[model samples]
Target: MKYRIGRVLISEGQLREKVKELGAQIREDYKGEKVIFVCVLKGAVIFFADLLREMGPEVDAQFDFLAISSYGASTVSSGIVKIQEDLSTDIHGENVIIVEDILDTGLSLSYISKLLRERAPKSLEICVLLDKEERRTQPVNVKYTGFKIPDEFVIGYGLDYAGHFRHLPSVHIAEPAE
Candidate 1:
């Protein structure tokens, strides 16, 4: 498929390597604790799938999904987030790791963190596949970060441009059409 861009920013191999690192870190930090991995939906589906596969032989974790929205069909955030789907299971007494494709404005992640915290999870954390710190208008921290990227519009490995290029094995910014 056409990438709509000339080159890849983060190749599939690069992302996979980071995921392996993330999994190993989690295994070390959590050690004996069990974690419920909450994957943000749509954009995170690919990342979540790949990440879980790499979490190691003995990492014990459950999985859930919460679909959130801010950009809708647009490629840019509007500084607001709405939950199109909420978690079906209670996070109370469970350790939670929130997994996401990219942490942009930090609004959606921050909002989800608060919402999940209200459930009184034993411990809550965030793991991001990509972080664009410059674009952040709100302060947000991620426990596991795959890459720190320039504040550019990226698509692939679950990131998208009006729902395009997600199947690409890497990340690329579409050249603005003339």
Candidate 2:
């Protein structure tokens, strides 16, 4: 069960350092306030877990999961976003942060953000591990971003190709076999 991984774009050490830095920044930004971290599930689970741990005891954070899909099992998005799962907890009046693995095309995040905004949270923000700015179709305001990558087919560090290659510690562009 081996997958062909392309050149490593971001190393494991880099991700660790960035996550810590982002966590510290998040703590400072939301100081004295409790934040409900809404993780975009499946892909973001790994990054979300690591980020929460990095936030340490100084930050007051709760968590929920929202599963939205635009990409099925393929490397490219279908351009249509669908909510596979919804939040379990009520976020009304709570400071909400949407945690996502990658911001590609911005369709899913944009749709999710709009949906969450309707819930009337005290504040709403977005935190993403990776941002593919070049492929963005919609303008999404991401508050905290770990990395801004070019438009590439990437996998690992929680990103995946058809549900595979997520266990890799580093991020790499996926070079499909001919």
Candidate 3:
């Protein structure tokens, strides 16, 4: 079941521009308040790092990492969200943002949002680098969206297929190797 990286779906330049825009939007929305960015681990780590840099020193942005897994070694999600790691910081009464790599069926993020909301944060929102609306099964609100992509198995830029291609600078479709 080998796979090959296909055409660029989102270029590195596009991602950088979108991240900057999202950072600006977040700064404006939060209005100089402190923000706690909870990075969804593994896939979102790369996007999280790049996004954080956009925040700059002027913005009081704090960050933590939590690992959630629905896809093990498969391209498609297993539909069961599991928390491999949890955030150490208490999010109660704080401006919290969940940064994710992609929103597909929306199961993982929906589950995560529900759990976080129960913690009673002052605000809870989602920021995703990619949104695949065609595959959304659960309704989840995404406050910041980098790109609305089509229904394709995409890789690169923190997205991956069976744990490969996550380090690629740009996003690419994951197609059959042949």
lDDT of 3 by residue, 1-178 (tens): 7789999989999989999999888877876688999999899999999888888765789999889889988888998999999999999999999999999999999999999999999999999999999999999999999899999999999888888899999999988997
The candidate scoring highest on TM-score is 3
In angstroms, how far off is 47's CA in candidate 2? 0.8
> What is the C-alpha local distance difference test score of each model?
0.86, 0.91, 0.92
RMSD of 2: 1.8
> 1-178, model 2: which lDDT tens digit per residue?
2347999999999999999999999999887778999999889998999989876677789999998888888788899988999999999999999999999999899899999999999999999999999999999999999999999889998888888899999999888675
lDDT of 1 by residue, 24-99 (tens): 8988888776789999989989999988887665777789999988997776887788999999989999989999
Higher-ranked by TM-score: 2 or 3 = 3
**Candidate 1 TM-score over all chains jointly:** 0.94
Superposed model 2: Cα runs more than 4 Å off: 1-3
lDDT of 1 at 22: 92
What would the C-alpha RMSD of candidate 3 be, to one decimal place?
A: 0.9
Q: What is the lDDT of residue 139 in candidate 1?
A: 81
**Model 2 quality (TM-score):** 0.96
| Candidate 3: residue 18 Cα off by (Å) | 0.6
